[model samples]
Target chain A: MPELLILVPFTGALLCFLFPGHIRDVIGLLCAVLTFVASIILTGNIYQNGPIRLNLGGWKEPLGIGMCVDGLSVLFIFLTGIVGLLVSLYSVSFFSKANNQSLAKHFWPLWLFLWGSLNSIFFVSDIFNAYVVMELISISAAALAALSGTNASLIAALRYFLLAMAGSMAFLLGVGFLYAQTGTLDMYLLGAVTDGGPLMAMALGLMTVGLIMKTALFPFHFWLPPAHGEAPAPVSAVLSALVIKGSFYLLLRIWCTVFQDTTASPQTATLLGLLGLTGVIWGSYQAIIQNRLKLIIAYSSVGQVGYLFLLFPLVFITLDPAWKIEAWTACVFQTISHGLAKAALFLAAGNLIHATGTENLKSMRNIADRLPMTTFTLALAGVSLMGLPPSGGFVAKWMLLQSILASGQWWLAAAPILGGLLTAAYIFRILSQAFVSDDQISCCGHVSFVMEKSALLLAIFSILIGFRSKEVIFLLSEQVYFVIQGGIIP
Target chain B: MTTLLIYAFTSIILFSIGLFGLVSHPNLIRKIVSLNIMGGGAFLFLISLAYHGRSPDIDPVPQAMVLTGIVVTISATAFALCLTRRIREKTGQCLLEHCPDKPET
Candidate 1:
């Protein structure tokens, strides 16, 4: 089933390339549905029993490459499925509305390749496999970013590609060091062999810096806004929603599981938390000042990504056992909430841009009456982004605050609230443009109902997830406890 | 252990040079080349780990990893070069627009 998770999209990508023009979208949709169903089944099976670890080609551990899916991997895989399905559906209508059939044809293969690469990353248990998949993800993403073929977009893609390569190289160096020290590539084995030596510390530093660069956290996020803003909307949605999370998931897995014994110093965790705090404040300020709607959301992603790092310091320092679960759940839930909300925001922003034939927020004035559905989608997604009541983002914030307070870190709690206020400022900025009664403001083009519906559905799910917090927390706890039980390296 | 430390130091120096070039260079080709150099240093580090006490006693895993790394590096460099060419053709400048003389104007 895990192999099928990778094979389905890869085969579909090949079929997409080989098949005729008319059937490419069909193949893409079929692959999305197949992968989504397979991921659900994989998650369910894992939940019912336990994590699955498979040695490829019948080769045993330390010799053969392996794939493993714990509760964490399942959570990410399920996210990829949901976001992939919505993006695939949105693409079908998005291209048709633009009447760019040729570009649409080129999009399917690259998109599938990226989707498969992401699945491979989440499932791989070997450090070397992680590096390879990271490269695969970077290459496919760079190509996808360049699909628009505009000067700005291409330049952005080039910069993104180069930085990503540098990041991956650093990561591979870390892998090399780990292999040298432990003589094993499997993460489970490495955990037992690794010690808090100079080599391990160096490897951790190199890998963390590399993964954070790829994740586009704060200072290294210079390339993200342009790449995201200039790309076709569906591509931007996937890049912002999933690709960035790939490296982040790696960092989380390594730090939380493999290097749990070699936890970074409290100072390092504090530094990371400070950087994240900077990202929230800085990214939100930039987002508020952006004229282009997509650029605003792109910058908003930089801010939202900050929330993910807040867990580092909390998880690293908290001695209370209960706070550990709270921090973990908050981190994972925050990831899911932001993923759905941001995807919805990008897709809806795409619709608005499509309808108005402009990305400038000013021209979007009075578009609420013109395209009410898209407007509603944007508002729904915005509510989640701002962490308002009865939304997934709100629940995440609540859990984060609870943990922060439990840890007696009252000062740290102010960051999220302030971030939320700034988020509201920017969201309302866009919403006000939509609500204004400007007679000259008019939507120039038709946005397909399918496109609007896809964004709306994702936004609804973003809110709906708030109600399912118990189940989400339960799934996260299952794996958290498993790690505590010393189940790996057996 | 001394030899390993020397090799590690050499890789670090190589990596730092590449990192310096990547940060300091304005030209896209230079940046790409810097990235390749950085990758070379990392691959060197990986391959060096395969070396054991004797010449024949080499680990197969790091060698295999280096081979895969080389393939990935080639493709990435190729893609970056293609984008460089496109940027050159589209704007007639390989330098990024971070300077005072912005390209858009």
Candidate 2:
């Protein structure tokens, strides 16, 4: 049954690539829905029997390839399914408006293929295969970013493309070092074999740098704002929301599992936490200074990513021995909430930009009455972004704060809170402008309801996450590590 | 240990040179070219470290990964070039350092 969850997207991608142009969006939406349903079923299976494991091509563990579906993979899987669906819905209206028939045909296949790549990355038992999936995702993402057909977007995509390649190559080298030392690429096998040695340490450094580059953490984030800001809105939504998380999810999983022993020095995790802390300040500063709305959201993503990494160091050993579950639960929850909220925000921004024919802040200040639904959805998404009361972002922030404080790392809490305020500041910058109702409002065509509804629905889900903390926490704690390693680690 | 350190040094030097080229060059195509050189250095470093100090003896897994990374990087570069050429066609200039400020929409 868990196998079905991964297979659905793969088959869907191929079908999408083969479909007739006119029906591709419909087929893609159906595929995303099916993938979501399958994931729900898979979650039920996990509820019954912890983590579900399957070997693809009949390969055994520590030998051939395998799929390990744990709480984290399921979380990301569910996110990809839902986000993939909404982006498709948004794109139908989006590309249709510009009469971009060519892009419409290509969008589904690339998105579905990306969905498959992302899902598989979370589940792959071997580090080597994870590298392959990373490359696949990068190609598709670069292609998607170029869909704008704008000169700025095209150059931005190219720059992003080069950086992603460089990062991937660095990761490949790190995998090499690991394989040399441990003689195994399987995460489970590596867990048993490797200790905090020099080669392994060096490998971890390489991998971390590579992953940070992809995550656009801070110093390495020059490629992000351009790639994200210049791309079409729906593409930007997925790039920020779903795709970027793939590398981080793997990094986190590796730290908790394969690189678990490497954290013994404490400096390693502390250094990472410091980087995240730095990112929060730097990214927020940039976001605040941006005049364009989408650029603001893109820079803000750099800030949010910091919290995820910092939370790692804050919770390394402080949680109640059982508190690993709570900390990771909060971590995963924070990630998904951000994804949902960011997607909605971008979609709303897209529709508004479309209606007003510009994303300039001075222009959108009078955009409120003309596009009320888009305005409301942006505010709703902002609630999640700001970590305000009753939104999932609020719950995620609360849980992370509790974990950090519990760990006695009081410094960590400052970032998320400050980050939230900045998030509120920038998001509200757009929100206030959205309320502009002056006669000077020069706008474009009205957006179709199709684009607005799914976006609102996503924003609502982000808020609804606040109420489901119990269930979501339970799901995140369900043994993702053991699923990959087959409970073989000592 | 000495051999590993030497390989790492060479990789870092090459990487630094490529980085310098990438940052210093204004041409979009040259940046891509420099970036790939950096990638080559990094990949070689990985292969060198993963080599078990013997011919046909190094682990095949990382080798396979490096191969896949090569293909993927090439594919991404191709797409990026297509985008770059298109951008040149439209705006007549690629952003080298400071982008020419177009008044905000």
Candidate 3:
């Protein structure tokens, strides 16, 4: 099943390259649906039986590549599946328009390749494999970002590509250092063998910095706004929603497992948390000031991402095991909720841009009357971003706040509270334009019903997940136990 | 042992130089070359690690990794070059800092 998760998208990507026009669209959609189904079955299998590990080509670990799916990875796979399918649906209509026909030719292949790489990142059990898969993701995602062919997008893609390449090099050097010290490429083996030595510390520092750069944590986020804001809508949705999460998931996994005991000092974790807090405030402030709708959403991603880094500090500083689990689950919740909300917001912004033929937020005055479905989608997604009640973002922030309070990190509590307010500020900034009555409502194009509904469904799912947090929490706790027991080394 | 130390120091210096060039230069082509230099430093470090032991045979793993790394780096550099060419053609700009910040329509 894990192999199926990778194989389907890759094969579909190859088929997409072979076919042309309508046939390629059908193949891309079919591949997406197949990948989603495989992910569902894979998740269920893990739920019923436990985590599954596959030795590629019947080769044993420490020799050949290994793919493993624990509770954490399965959750990510499921996310990619859900977002990939809807985005695929959205893209089918998105690229069918007259102007986007040239883009459709490249979008299918690159997107499927990206999906395959994302799945592989979640499944790989070795650091070197993670590096390789990350490179694959960076190249494909950069290509997708440049699909719009605008000067801004082209420049953004170049900037993004260069930074990501540098980050990957740092990551590779870290991998080299780890392999030098431990002589093992497998993550579990490295965890078992490593001690709190200078080599381990160096490797940890290098890898963390590399991953942070790739994740676009506050200080390194210069390329994100332009790249994400300038991409075509579906591509923007995917890049904002899923691509960044890929590196983040790897960072979480490596920090918790291989570096958990060796060199993951409390000070370093706290430093990460501090950066995250600043990102929340800084990114939200930037979002509030952006004139363009997509740029606003892009900056909001930087803010929301700050919440994920809070997990490191909360988990590291707390002594109680229960609080640690809460922090872990909270971070994952934040990731998923933010991903869905951000994706929905971008797609909605896309629709608004499409309708008005403008990216300016002020021109969207009276959008409430022009495009009710999309406006509602934006509002619902806004509720999630604001961490309001009965939304996934609310659940994540609530759990995060509880864990922060329980751990006596009173200072850390400011981020979610203050960040939420700032978030609401920007969210309302966009939403407020809906109510303003302007005579010159210049809606130039028609948005297909399918495009609006897909975005709406994604927004609805972001809220719906809030009501069903128990299962996700349960799955995460199970994985946490597996990590604690050191049961995965086999 | 001395050889290993020399190689390691050389790799680090190369990496730092590339990083400096990457940060100081705004020209797209120079940035691309700096990225490759950085990659070269990393690959060299990996190669040096493969020879850290006093055995008759060198470690094959890092060697394999370096080869794969080189392949990935080549493809990435090629892509960067393509984007650079397009940017130059479309807007007649070669420096990243010179690109305009207007929102796409």
Candidate 4:
């Protein structure tokens, strides 16, 4: 089953490429449905029994690549299943309306292939395997981003591809550093072998720099705005919404599981957390001022990611370290909520742009009546983005605040409060545009129910996920309490 | 000891140079090339860090990592190349490409 998760989409991708244009959508849909069903079964099987550890070619952990279906990996696989399905379906109508069937034919297979790569990244237990899967995700994503077929889009994709290479290389070097000391690339094996020394330091530096670059963390984030802004709206939606999360997911996984012992210094975590806080402020500030709606959302994504890192300092505030679970949970919840909300916002924005034939903020200012459904989608998503009542973003932010308050980091309290306010300001800037009723607004076309409805569903999930906090927490807790110190390594 | 450190220092300098090129160069392909150089430098630095008592005794992990890095870099460059070619084919102008003039004159 572990191997099949890697197998299914890869085979599907090849078949899609080799086969003719006929039935491509059907093939893509089947691949997503089957992958989702397989994931659900795997989840039930794991919950009923234990982790399924698979070694490739019958090789052992330290010798060959391995895959593990722990609680975290399973949850992410499920997200891939869900998000992949919606994006695939949305792509069907999205391209159809544009009358670009040939483009649609090519898109379905590549997108499904990307879906497969993302799911496998979550399950890989070996560092080298993780590297390979990250590469797969990055390549597929670069292709998808470049599909817009514009000069600027291609150049932007080109720029992003180079920067992404630099980041990936740094990550690989970090793996090399670890191998130098531990002589193994299996994450589980490295756990028991590592100590907070020179090799570990080098490895940590390499890994964090690579993942942060992938995440588009502040200073290294030059590639994001152009790549996203230049891509087709749906492609931009997924790139901003889902693909970037893969690296951050790995960052969180490694920070909690592998680097926990070494990175336990609260002061260091606090400094990292501060870096995140700055991303939030800087991202939001730029987001509010952007004239282009899509660019604004892209920059806002940078700011929102910063809030997740704030949980690090509080992860071990008690010095007991048992509370790392809360820190990890807060961060993950923020990630999931923002991902769902932002995807919906971008999709809705795409719909609006498609209908109006422009993404200018000034034009959107008087075009609400023309795009009723898209407006509703953006508003609902904005509710979650602003971290207000009855929404998952609210609960996620509340959880982080509770932990910071509990840890007596009263100063850290300003981050979520001010960040949320900044978020609201930008969200409202877009939202207020929805209510403008000027007769001077000349829009282009009409958006359909399927496109608008899919956006709404993801947006609503962003709000409702907060209600499942306890269950989600329980689901993620089975493997280890995020920061495992005194346990067997592999 | 000094040989490995020197290699590592050279890699660091190369990476910094690539970073400078990335920010300074407006050409798309040049930017892509610089990025690969930076990646190469990082790989070199890692291999240097893993350099030990002898070449034969050196860490296999860094070597494995460098190999994977090379593959990923190639794949990314391939996709970006595809996109760049498509852009050049469509617009017929690459040097003066800018997005600000989109949607209108």
Top model by DockQ, which number? 3
Give candidate 2 regions above 4 Å deviation.
A1-7, A15-20, A317-324, A442-444, A482-490, B1-20, B42-59, B91-105
- Calculate model 2's interface RMSD in Å: 3.5
**Residue A179 CA displacement from its true place in model 4, Å:** 1.3
After superposition, the stretches of candidate 3 with alpha carbons farther than 4 Å from their true spots are A480-490, B101-105
DockQ of each: 0.56, 0.44, 0.69, 0.46
Ordered from best to worst TM-score, the candidate numbers read 3, 1, 2, 4
Task: For residue A225, give model 3's deviation from the true position in Å.
Answer: 0.3
Superior by lDDT: candidate 2 or candidate 3: 3
Predicted candidate 1 versus true structure: per-residue lDDT over A1-490, tens digit per residue: 9999999999999999998766998999999999999998987887777677888899997878888888889889988999999999999988765456768878999999999999999988888889999999999999999898877888888888888988998898898877777788888777776467777887888899999999989999999998898888999999999999999999988787667746467777878888888899899999999999999999999999988998887888787867867887898899999999999999999998887877889899878888899889899999999999899999999999899899876767866888999999999999999998887665568788899899999999999989988877767887532353222221
TM of each candidate vs. truth:
0.96, 0.91, 0.98, 0.90
Give the residue spans of candidate 1 off by over 4 A.
A480-490, B54-56, B98-105
Which docking band does candidate 3 fall into?
Answer: medium
Candidate 3 Cα deviation (angstroms), residue A362: 1.0
Ranking by DockQ: 3, 1, 4, 2
Can you give the lDDT of residue A365 in candidate 2?
69
lDDT per residue for candidate 3 within A115-229, as digits (tens), equals 9999999998999989999999999999999998988899899999999998998999899888878888988777777577888899999999999999999999989999999
Every model's Cα RMSD, please?
A: 2.3, 3.2, 1.7, 3.1
Residue A332, model 3: lDDT of 96
